[model samples]
Target: MWNKRRRHFESYPEIVIVHVSGYGRPESGGDPKKCKRGCYDIISQAYSGWCKLASTPEHEVYRLPLYAGNYVTALFGAMEMLVAYIHAQKTGEGQVVDVAQFEAIARIIEMYYTQCIITLEY
Candidate 1:
């Protein structure tokens, strides 16, 4: 796959690219407008499909628990894409913009970890 893409890029004098990684590309991934708890849970849950907020076909919003950093990251990613798009339009160049689900969680976790480490001294 890499070789094929490299060959294709040979045609362009110097083409720019924008890359992202996640459950799937934002285009292939579900719509961000109406994202749900299920979408976020896919990555947040250590055990996949293990602890789900009880909801029926007619979901009762009041019953839903807020296990939702995934949604926050998804929305943040969309915002980043908008900025990247504007940059590309103005400069006529593109760049890679990766937003991995686990990676985003890891970042948040590390910040928390740092706090724990700091408290250890006290």
Candidate 2:
């Protein structure tokens, strides 16, 4: 469907498409079965290691109830869409923005961990 629409890019050059997926680009290389599987908030959380961030004192990992992975993906997607929109407006060329939920969650998790380490008391 997107491939077909891409063919008409010249017709609508200002189009800024934002695609949000659970894993990532289907062709980016990974388990083919996982690429085809339907995604949920919890699935992305687990895949991105977001669940591991919320462990008990015993270190038993668990998922958060706030759907942080899903929300983060959406926030990232919206930001990308805005950037793409700006580019389209300037160049009169359309662009596709792909936001992976797992990667998005991983990004935030990495940032948080980095900050924690930076502020860690010696």
Please tell me which predicted candidate would have the highest lDDT against the true structure. Answer: 2
Would you list the C-alpha lDDT of every candidate in the order shown? 0.48, 0.78
After superposition, the stretches of candidate 1 with alpha carbons farther than 4 Å from their true spots are: 1-64
Candidate 2 lDDT over residue span 20-85, tens digit each = 878766555546776667788999988877676676667677888877777889999999899999
In candidate 1 the C-alpha lDDT for residue 114 amounts to 59
Candidate 1 — which pairs collide? none
lDDT, candidate 1, at 111: 54
Give the TM-score (vs. native) of candidate 2. 0.80
lDDT of 2: 0.78
The residue pairs that clash in candidate 2, if any, are none
Scored against the true structure, residue 110 in model 1 reaches a CA lDDT of 60
lDDT of 1 by residue, 4-108 (tens): 546645654234444434333444453454232233544543322212223234653222246555664576577667887787678765544555454454554
In angstroms, the error of model 2 at 43 is 0.8
* Ten residues in sequence with the least summed lDDT for candidate 1: 46-55
Best candidate (score: TM-score): 2
